[model samples]
Every structure is written in structure tokens, then in C-alpha cells.
Target: MSTAAVVRYWLACDFHRERRIRAVLSSFHTAGGQLQPGIVDHLAGRRINQIKPSQPNKPYSAAEWERLAQACNTMIKSANTDHRRAVEASERGMESSDASLSEERLAWIIRSSGPLAIRSLMELFPTATVETHQLVVSLRRSLFPDQDVAFAYNLLFAIRTGIVPDGIDALLTGDVTRTGPSSILLSYMKGRTGKESLVLSRAAVRVLDQWLEHSALLRGHAGDQGSQLWLGTNQRTKEGGRTIFTTPRTQYRRRVWAQRAGLIDDDGGRLQIHGGRVRATFHHLKDRSAWTGRTTIDPNHSAKVEADHYLSSHTPAQKDAIEGIIEDAQTDIRRKAAPPLVTNERDAAKFAQQFPNLVQEAELDLPAVQKLLDAEQDVFVAACASPMKSPYAPVGKLCPARPWVCLLCPLAVFTARHLPNLLGLKEYFSAQAAQLPLPQFMGVFGPYAARLDEEILPRFSTWEIAAAAGNHQTLPLTLEEQGCY
Candidate 1:
């Protein structure tokens, strides 16, 4: 098989081919760099293909990703500090005996502990020369800092945004554009949508920005490294403008960092960095773009290819999300899923009476909908004039009670789209009530609690509610989200 095809097959099955091959050959030993079983005859009748690949599962959780990032960053800070102090001591005209660090100790520190341990060793023995400490610190920092942080940031970005490892290294300053909105644009190779403009979330943007600053500092000493995104002690050639990490070193560094951060599985195997990130990107897009029927994470890949290679794993949330989507799709299949174009009052009333469960998808010239909104119903907006106090009150008149009280009020116009938002409000109030004293809970959530129980949820079937939640982004923003809180 071709190398890329082999990789895809391994990822599809979540297996390690090399390890499986080793297991198959455990009984054989090599002599003079050849298998002892006489390879020609052994392969003639061997059914070597019978060995099945083992299925593996090792994706990092959000908490685990954060831990690895923090761990990597902490080492980076310590390593940089050690370099600065040693350089400073050299500049101060201190003799070699005044500040000492041995090559053996430096090697051990770099291999096992961080810069702090090296500093502790230096302090333990004040007999070595300053020149020795300076040289050791400089060499260690040069080799370690760039690889340490570059791998961490690259892996984290890949996990969150689904940037391929090659794509991460291919990034340039101009590629990180913020044309509008909170997200920054990330242009990468082989885009499905003609060099598609991908976006990094606000959080990912912050980390990338930090890495950019550090990369600039490293560039001061990174001779001939060119403008490649990841810079180490390695030099770049003028023709290709590539660093040593352009090959397999990036993956090697990723393994090192993953091991250091305790991200290895209980089986002592590291997760598939590229495949894991791609899977995460698939699910994140599914979650944020639920209103859209399809996820567009890998636009270049066919749907069948995506299912086979990328979207092979599932989390509990993902399964629930898929089930919700299926239920919504089934509802769309059953109900008259199109809007009734009834501009006049008579037809509007007729449509409303016949399909009380359905809502309009297209805008009509009807005065009520026009007065309430000029655009499509992405979210439910209301002019509240309740006697109860509510988070929604600041949008209009005050409410004397909780927000769900507006559901029962005549001034509040609700569609099936409001179902998910209402259900979310119900859960929020329930949780709040759980922590309060009885009387306080009653005072806080008593009416709203009863309203959700006695009035709201029973009005529609659970399937109908689920369908409405997926109805083209119809849920309204909470008061806090709308700047009311």
C-alpha cells in the first residue's frame, strides 16, 4: 500500500501497524540482519495477513489538554530563566568557579527535570567555572526551548481547530488575520473550499499570539531559520525555506511532550495526535453548527471519506447530539417543513389554526411579524411588559417574577423555536433552587418552577421540542448574553 493509504487505514482502525507486525514476528529472531526462519520459504505459505489490528482509543479530554499546555509552558518559562541568568553571570565577569554547571548534570536535567533542577545543581557545587555554566546553559536552551513550546502549541491548536501538523508549520504572520468578529482566519493547504478561510476560536487565538511573541524572541538567535513558523536551533536552506522539523521531528517532539505531560494512556501508548485533533475538530463543528444540518470541518473530503477516516469515534455528547439530529430530521420529514406564504390576515389565521405546532420559516408581509422582526427568526425576541422582575425585563418593562413567567403572559409571543431556550431556563432555575433554603428557593424559583411543570413542557411533545431546537438557530440569547444582566 502507498504510505498515505497505509496511514489512513491505520487511523481508520485506530491501530499501530508496526506494533502489530512485531507481535506477529515475536517468535522470529534476527541473525546477520536476517530473519532466522528462512524468509523465502516462510513467506511462500505464510498467512501473515490473518493478524487483525487492535482497536485503540486515546483522545485527550479538555482538562487533559489544558494540563499539558500548562505543563509545557511552565517548562518553557523555567528554561528561558535559566538561560538569562547564565548569560547574565557571564556578562558580570564572574569566574568559572563562581557559577558552575557540568555537561553531565546539564544533560540529565534536560533529559528528566526542567531548568530549575539544573539551577539547583549549579548552586549545590560552586566550584565549576562561569564559562562552563554559560556554555552549558546556552547549548541546552538552544536545543530545548523551541522544540518544547512549538510542539505544545502546535498540538493544542490542532486539537482545538483541526489544523493539520503541516498546516501549523506552514502558517505565516499574514495568515493570522482578524478581518471581523472574535475569530481569526487560518489559511492552510488543500482547502476543500478553494483555499478555505478557516477560523481559530478566541481562546486559540490568544495562545497563538503568545507563541508568536516567543517565536520572535527565538528568531534573534535562530540563524538562517527563515520565516518558517516553527523555529528551533536548526537552520533553514535558502531554496526551500524549511527547517529540520519539516520532516518527522515534529511528531517526535509531540511524543516527548505528551509523555512529559502524562498524556499517555494506561496501556503506555500515546494518542494519535493528528487523528485525535481531526476528530475533535469534527465534534466541535458539529456542536457549534448544530443548526446547520451538515458539519463542514473537512470540506475537501467526501462525506463517506469523512465517516470512514475522521468521524470514526463518538463521545456521549456526540451520540446524544446525533440522536437529537436524527429526531429533528424525522420530524422534518413528517411535518409540512416549509413556511406558508400567507400575507393576509385571513390566510395567516387559517394556517395558524391548522398547523398550530408549526411556525413560519420565510418572512411574510404580515404586520405582526414585521413589527416584531425585520429579518429571519434566528432567535426569539420579545417586548416584555410584565409585572414580574426578570432578566429579560431590561429589554422592556420590568417583571415581578422570574423569566419563565413571561411564557404565560399574552405579551410574550413564542414559537416552537423558543422551546430549547425555555428548557435551558428551566434547568438553570432548577439548579439554582437546589442550593437554596426551602423558603428562599420558593421565593426565587417557585412560580417559574411550577410554570415549567404545569404549563410549558406539556404544551409540546419532546420530539417537537427537539426538532424546534435544531430549527435553523432559533434559540434566543439569555439576558446575560444580550448584555441585560
Candidate 2:
């Protein structure tokens, strides 16, 4: 069959919801003529129609089974190749970085199942609780399935076993460099392609233990800077720490670590210990006493996306927001935008320091690039934000009770087409939620701190976070003694 035909057959597998499948594939109008129509996750042979009506497509004959297997393999291989191509394209976009998410690793993620996948996940996560486990599994299904389903499953397995598989940190960094095939764990399984690597690690078990005990080190920041750039997800490592992470989900973990570390101040402001990205955490730190870092959490996250039905902040606005985000970092990313320095981080940093400031001094403070990021966020916030409410509706605020239209939106099209991507977005949304308004659950919990009235930050405030280490002390916020969000 043609590539287009193969794509259509692949979609008609029995595992999919018919309505959902249609919604997802609706955009691929080109495939209409070439494909079979059915649910997803089915592997079938040529003349697959002979299978039971309700069952997944089947291999009618022995020869057909082999053909089906070949098709499945081909389909999977094509996805892996496509993913690598995407990765390569991204690398080229980023100036041709030498690394790529290798094929061996992608294969491992897709084919492996059971506890073996769990063992591989532990190196990055110490202990995967039920919630975390469910999260990992969901993320696995949503991650690049054609590429890293097992890798995702391994992450889920780690959660179940409380193991932290090695290289998980790399995954968080969007790195998919696969380690070589395993030997020790799978020695017992005969046919020995020696591919059965578990997702957890001995070190991860220890980390999980430490994490559970809240024993891992937690540092507070005393100051932070974030006036000209978006607070990056990964803060600089303390001294020689090997892992650097900034994905919204990792930021949540960092915030949890901070809470355990006792880093956030009495008020919602994050403390900068020496000069790390504590300020980075502040981007999402809405409440005092919990600078849990910025995240794009699930559920309401699309509210930002859904809000797109509301407004467009424009490119200039985007550029300004990025400018503020960068100013806080005062990095040279901006200078890199010019054709001359566009590819160099150092040059980027230099330009970040120079151009915008020059523009500010010259009084044309509304620089173009700053507006770009602002526009981006505004576009996103608007697009993703929910139009769940309207003046036409009858409610105090937009009722959260209305049905969400996630199933049919353009965003949903991708979510349905790629479960792992949806899962990633869910995790990202969850992380953002971790930083949102912590409800009292109807007078069940105490406030993180008293309300801030003496000091009303009319708008967002930026403080300079010098490069210190971790563990900064927080200034107490004396509220009206009465509490509020």
C-alpha cells in the first residue's frame, strides 16, 4: 500500500473510539480515498476485512499475518525515522547540535512492556507513587509513541516500582540518546537480543527513599532577576550538578523540592539563595509561601488555549513580555537574533544585554523582539484560554460546569492523533496547575500566608538574583492576620 494508504489503515484499528478517530483524522482530508475505516491500535493482514466485525482487523491467512507484521514493522520504522528527521530538523534549526534521539532507544520504548520498562525509568525518578505512576503511563502513551512508547512505559514502570531509571534526566531535557542494549536483567529471557532493560535504578530507589523522607537538599533563593526574559525552566545547577532541567513538569518537581527545602518566603515571593533561577520559579508563584515554579498544567491549561477565543495580545506584546523575562536574566539571547549572531548563545547573551537597553535609553522601549514573545504568550493565553464563559451566559464568573470542547478543537485533533503528545500537554498543564490558586477545599486548609496589603505589587515585580548557591531565607509577610489567596 502507499504511505497514505498505510496511514489510513493504521488509523482504523479496533482500539480507537470511532468518533474520536474521525475528529482526529479529519484534517487529513487527503487520506479519505486511500484508507480503510476502523478504530485504532489494530494490526491486520491484507484483506483484513475477514476478521470478526467487532474485532480488530485480522490476518485472514498465514501469509497475510506475515505481511501484516511487515506492515506494522514498517509503520513503526517510518514513525521512528520521521521522529529522527524531526529531531535532526530541530538540531539544524538550533545550529546542528551533534546529538539526536537514536533509533535503538526509540525501538526499546515501543516494543518493551512489563516490569522491564519500569526498571529503566528509576534512574531519573526515585519513587513513582500511584499518581506519578499513572502520570508516567499516561505520558508514555502520549509521548512520541511511534518513537518512545516503551520509554514512556518505562517511566510509568519506574513510578510503580519506586525506581529511578538512569537517563530519565535526559528525557526531561528532550534528550533521547539511547543507552546500549541491556545484558544483566534479561539474561534469563532466552532469544536474547539482550534488549530487556528495566526502567528503574538502585540509585533511584535511594533517591526515592530520600525524596519520600523529604531528605534531599532543598535550597532557597534570596533574590531573583527576570525582567527581560521568560524564566527558563531549568535553573543553573548549584556547583557541579549534572542535570539541568526546565520542562514545566520538572519545574514542578523542583518546586516540590523547594517546599521540602523550605525555600519559599512567608509571602508568595521566591527567595534567591545566591543567584539561581529561584526567580525563574517566581513566574508561576502566585501565592506567597509557595514559589512552586511555573507550569502549564492540565485541565484549565487549555483555558489559556481556549482563551484564544478571547483576545490577541499582538506580536509587540509578546516581544515585551520576552524582554521582561530576559531582562531578569539579563542574558545575551537577544543579540543572537541578528543575522550575525543568530546562531551563537554567547552572541545571543551579548545582544540580550545591549540592544534592548540601548532601545530603552533611546526611549523606544517597545523593542520588536520583546513584543514577539509577548505576542506569543498572548496568542497562546488567548488561544488556549477557554471561552467557557460569555457575557451572554448567566453565572457569577464563567461557570467551570460547562462541557469542555477538547474533543473537537484543532488542539484536540493533535491530542487524538498522538496520545503521548496529549499526555505531555496534560503533564505540562498539571505542572502549571501546581503553581495556581490553591483552593481551601471549603475551609479545610490554612493559607500559605496572610494577604499582602502593605506591599501591593501593582504589576509583576522583578528583583535581581545574583548567582548565589541555594537556600536563601524568606522575609516573613505579616498579613492583616486574616488570610486570602
Candidate 3:
């Protein structure tokens, strides 16, 4: 059994143990044999936390996958070319009896009279010099390849569609439903997932078409015997026996094909081709193509599985990119969590004592603090410590941020002097709240509005708020502000 099955079996055993414990506890209670409260709780809550095993198979490297794909393509192309030529030559009415034992005559005989028994080929060409086995093998290969060719089609299909080998093995002619001129909806049974369907890509569709055409002659000859989509002649048939078209179900045949292809691993050893690893490689390449600013996990996988199996095994560049994203997120959280600097006092010494780090970070001296208090460095809504040093804009550039952005900015300082403008901005927010939907207003302006009311305004006295409200002017909003709402 697989590792997953073993884990599940142990978990079931744990459950059965817990059930038996419950039964024993109930019998004890009936007999008036009291148990300790802690023991009873522990028995009732007993569970086995099974740690799932990590997937052992890793995807092929990009270069390795490309090499395998190119090899498959070459074999497929050669097979198709030979099949087409054989069919065209047969159409020219080339008589097999008129020619001697040659490649062209063998092709004509196979295409015209179906795959012949070796005894029949000997009867037709009685004086042939070549060995009977060699002749039959060469003719069958040119027309439709041996059962081992199924491996090439299966591998290419898995590489293109990310389907498991079991799914490809289970395919039938009826399972393919054409949705468009160049697309098909292929339905197959996965051993683990049961029945599933996928709309194949154009490239996958092309590969399927080629396989179907290449196997069509054998499929026709086999009739009902060739129900499986992957049909090829059995190469090991007894001498003088008819060619047998059947599905290639054995892994030995696939391994033989891999050996012929000379696939190699990173360590210069023979590549052990696993269906699951092929699927993983497809998903990996897909993820690389679809990657935006963040990691995009496959929807078919659980978040934990995606992270543990795929995301954990990254290249150095990918690791660096992920680290950068994490650092940016942590920095943003810290910046947003810092308390706003609001004070009514004009004493620069007291301000410096209250926010020594901020004063040093922004390089604000006593004269600069005094200037800030006197409204010499005022923005639309707050007194900016440094107008040209906004975090939202480049250093030494005037801030191009919206007025509401100042409410949460680290350099912004609120005092009684800026209260009238603050009250006016609050009024503007209220107007916007009325005009916009609740969700939209919350998404667009909720954080700034909350910071202004809950963190900045509450610091001032009630009389000061009243005085500011009385002196506040109702400034008209710009079209830029009104347009978005």
C-alpha cells in the first residue's frame, strides 16, 4: 500500500481505540467504578495526528524536460511520415507479388492486406534472403510501430495535460469529445480522483490527433479488440503468427522505450520517468508563466500541499523573490502600526523627547520643529515635517499623494493650527460616504477616515474641536475627487 493509505489505516486504528475506550468507560460508570476527571477527558479527546509524508518525486529540470519532449517529437514525426508514405504508396496500386522481398513491397503488402502473419510473408516471398523475423519486424515498424511506441504518446500526453498515467491508460475512443475544430474535451478515470475531464490545449489536441492517425490502421484491423485508444502491434509474437494489436499496459515496455531514447538525469544516470513527476513539471512551467507579483498555487492542490511540495523546492532566484515579498509585507505592517504624531504643545524640546527616533530619522532640529508648529511646512490637511521627503514619493520630490494619504503618513503632525482644514476634510469624507455605496466607501476611504477620527482628532480637547468647527470653511471639492466616487 502507499504511504497515504498506511497513514489513513493508522488513523482508523486510533479511532477504533478511542471508541473502545469510550465503551469501557461507559461500562465502568454503570458498575459505579468512578474514573478521574482528567483521565476521562484524556480518553474522550484521544486522537492520532498523522503527519502526511512528503511527495518523493521531483519534477524534471527545464533542460531535461525539453530534451525528453524533443525526443518524443522526433519519434512521433518519423512514425507519422512513414505511415503517410506507406498509405500513399498503397494507393498507387503497387502489387506486392510483382516485387521481390524489399521495403517498398513490404509496405504495400502491409497497407493493402493488413499486417500479415510471418508464415504468409514467407509463402509470398519464398526465396527471400532476409530472416523472417527481421522482415516482419521492419514492415510492422514502418506501418504502425510496436507496443513500445505507446510510451512516447503517453509521456507526451501527460507532459502536455498534466494528467496521471492511469488517466492516460484508461482512455477510450468514446472518451474524446470534440468541442471545436482544434480542441477536445477528454474524459478519463484517475485511479485516485475517479472520473475527471479536461479541455485539452491545441498542442495537446494536435498530439492526440497524430496518435490517432498513426494507430488508425491497426485499430481498424483489430476492430472491437482495439477498444483502447493506445493500440500497437505486439513485437514478441511467436514466429509465423499474425500481428496482435493491443494496449501497452506494462511498465517494462515503457522502460525499454526510455532506454532507447537515452533519457538522462542530472547526475548522468538513466532517468527514471515517473508519471507524477511529468505532471509536476507541467504545473511548474505553468506557474512560471503565470507568476505575477506573488506565487500562484495550482487550484487543484491544497494550500499546504502546494506550499510544502512545490513552493518549498524553489531555485535560488525564486527563493530571493519570495524573501523580498515577505520583507515588503513586514515593513508595510510596521509602518502602518506606528502611532501618529499629534500634539498641541509648541515646545520643540518636548516634541523631540516624545518622538526622538522620528526627529532623528527625519533630521528635524529645533528650528525645523518650530517651523512645523508655525505652519511653515503645511500640506492640505496636516503640518508635514518634510514635504519633499514623503515615503509615497521619491526622495527630494514634492509629494504627489492624495490629501487623505496625509492622515496616515509618518511625517504628518496634527495640532490645533491644522484643525479647521482637518474638520473640512472630515466633512468631505462624510459627503463621499453619503454618495458612495457602503462597501465601496469602506474599501476606498475607510482606513484614512478611521485613523483621522479614532487616532488623530480624539487627542485634542472638546473645546478645541468646537472652536475649529466654528472657524472651518466649506471648501468645494475638486472634480478629480468627485469623479472616482
Candidate 4:
């Protein structure tokens, strides 16, 4: 057996493991000097597809997402209020001396001096009353949260920006720059995509500003340690009891915050708040079809990744709407692929015999088909069998389709009489192709021009085409059509 066959047999039931093993072997092959063909070479054209898990980490439901957002917002708001009160009390002549210890006094001390003043306050009043010590500890906990208050700010920012967790964690003070009055340019590093930047929305800017204010006191005390945009306190230290200036790292602390906030998922269990899930929820709730007339949601990501990871995962209603759009596109493709119903003869003598399926499909009898061939139902270019029953317009109204639209319309019939107009349309298409860009010309007139040149005109005899070409003139056209030339 080949190397690929042997590897496949060895890991037949564990495709995920097989993919990892293959990746390792591929890396080894590259590191080595390619001494032999090896396993990676044998598995080159084949894909070891892993089975998707039945219950993947799907985007959170709307209710769960809203709860998460509200919880984060509440925590941030409370921190902001506490920070504001502390600043205000400090300005009102509250002192950190041993005169009398109160919450406002402790707040003033922490605000004036750094968080380190809490230790000094305890030392200054060793035999102080129980209420004084309690007040000092409570004030410290409120101002510099030991549980990493940065989590709330970081989660809220991620929820709004849809940035990956690594990008958020790697952010520094210098990464945030004010680009406009209401917007900020945030630069961060992503492991996979390297350095990236985004112009934050007004809402995101507000959240970031609140966080900066909330952590401003600690940052001033921290100096070099506060460079990392997020700062909290580490209460687990045995020496100083609670050390200030920390970053959000552990998931356990975030879970504690979630529990404190009383957040619950759809299953009524404790909400598992992770940065990845938060980012996914942000994208899931965003309008994927909305064009901002600028850049994409995440320009660093490829279209395949965007579709596979985010766009493909949607609620039932979204899936239904997307399916409807896909069905319409498929129907249009099938209609365009159908050959144009053009005939050289001017009468319906052989219309039924030549195109019996079309005749039956349109439910056209001999007299109705004859009327189409005799130009009685003539439009600008072709004779429409039933103008009132056109698919391009309302059922009871005339088709307001463009002249070239008849080339692909199922209800249209072409005969020798339309040759002069058809030749004129071909010239019009040529002029359009010259003026418009390649992609635009291909998108707008490619199908119609292709049908006319390759299908409709080819059915006519060379002598008949020559005769029609001689009679071809500047045909009467609408303002829209005349403007194109």
C-alpha cells in the first residue's frame, strides 16, 4: 500500500488526529532536505476531512447575548460611578491622615496617592476600629478590583469590536489613537495576521474612554507597569496582601465576575463567558449584508473563512431568508443558460415542430404563435408572445424590460423581420463594451451579447444577414439606450 493509504488506515476513525499528524509530518518534510517523497507528498491531492462536531460552539442566542452585553455594561457603569465619586470626594478636601477613617477618606487617599496608600493607611492606624479597616478594604476593592475589573471593559470592547481575544490582550497604551472626535484608531497584534488596526465606532470609543478613566488612577501609580492598556489588582499576594497593577489572564476570574453579575444562558446555567464566544456573538448579531461604503467587517479574514465560520452560522429565520436569495440566483442562472428562441423563418409554419417544448411551456396555440412570428406582438427587438404575461414585469402589465433583455426572455420570439434591429443592438453592445470597464461590461451586457452573436445571428443564412445588415439603421431607442452610444 502507498504511504497515504497506510496513514489513512492507521487513523481512519480519528480524522482530527490524522490532520494534526499530517501537519507535523509536513513540517518535518519542509525542515528536512526532502530526502524522499514521504507521507505528505503521498497525501498531497487528498484531504483528511474531520467530522464536524454535532454541537459546536454555536453563536449565543439573542437573549443570552443581550444578557451578556447588559451585564458587562452594568459592571463598567458601576466602576465608572465609583471612580467618579472617588475623584469628586478627593476634590472636596477629604484627607488620608489618621484623623478619622471613612469610605470617602479612603477614596481620597487612593485617588491622591496610588493604591499603595491603602497599606500605609492600615499601618498608620494599627489599632483602629473594625469599621475603619473594613472601610479601607472596601474602598480598595471598589477602586482597584482584585478580580480584574478589566475583564468587563475588555469583554464589552470585544462584544462591540468583534476583535479576537489575542488582539485585545496584546493591546498597549500607545495602540489607541484618536482619529476623530467620536472615533478612535485602535492598533493591535493578531497572532495569525500580524499587526492590524481598526477605526472604532462611537460606541466602542465610549467604552474604551470609560475604561481609561476607570483605570487612570492605577495607571498613574503603575508608571511602566501600566503600559498594558488593562490593569487590575492581585489580591492573592501574601506580602502586601493585595498588590495593584495586573492584567486579565485567568478565565476563573471572569467566571466569578459572571456569577456576581447573575448572568445566565438559555439553558438557565451559568453563562460561559469566553472572549472567542463574545467575538463570535458580536459578528453573529451584526448585519452581514450592510455595506458601510468603506471597508469590510474584518478585512484581514478571507471570504471563505468569513462564510464558513460566521455567515454560515445563523438563526432559523436568517437561514430561511438566505435560502430564498440563493434560490432566486439559481433560477436566474437557469434562465440565462437556456438558448434564445430565434428562428430564421418569418412564419409559424415550423414553430411548433422546431420548438415543441417551448410552445407547450408557453401554452401557445397555432394562432398565438403565428401572431408572435408576424410581428403583431413586436417590441423594440423581438416579438413577445404575451406582453401582459411577461416574467420580467407584473402579470397584468406590459414588460418594461430593456431591448436587450428580450434576448434572454423566455416569452420572446425572434424572426427574420427583427434582423435589422438585432444588428443595431449588436453595434450598441460593441460601443458599450468599448466605453465600460471589462468587468462592468461583462456583468451588464455579456449574456445578451453572447446570445445574440453566438445563438440568434448564427441561425440566419449569410445572404440573409448581409441583406439585413444593409438595411440596418440608427433604430429608434429610448433615452436610456441612446445615452449608452
Clashes of each: 11, 118, 0, 0
In what order do the candidates fall by TM-score, top score first?
4, 3, 1, 2
Off-target runs (Cα >4 Å) in candidate 4 are 1-57, 93-98, 116-121, 240-242, 288-485
The digit string of per-residue lDDT tens for model 1 on 315-342 reads: 8899899999998677544432232221
Query: On TM-score, who's better, 1 or 3?
Result: 3
Cα RMSD of all models vs. native, in order, equals 24.3, 36.3, 15.1, 14.4
Error of 2 at 230 (Å): 32
Error of 3 at 379 (Å): 35
User: Could you tell which candidate, 1 or 2, scores higher by TM-score?
Assistant: 1
Superposed model 1: Cα runs more than 4 Å off: 1-131, 138-144, 178-183, 191-194, 234-249, 266-272, 275-282, 285-485
Alpha-carbon error at 454 in model 4, in Å?
A: 30
Full-model lDDT for every candidate: 0.51, 0.30, 0.77, 0.77
Candidate 2: stretches off by over 4 Å = 1-61, 96-143, 146-485
lDDT comparison, 1 vs 4, better candidate: 4
Candidates 1 and 2: which is better by lDDT? 1
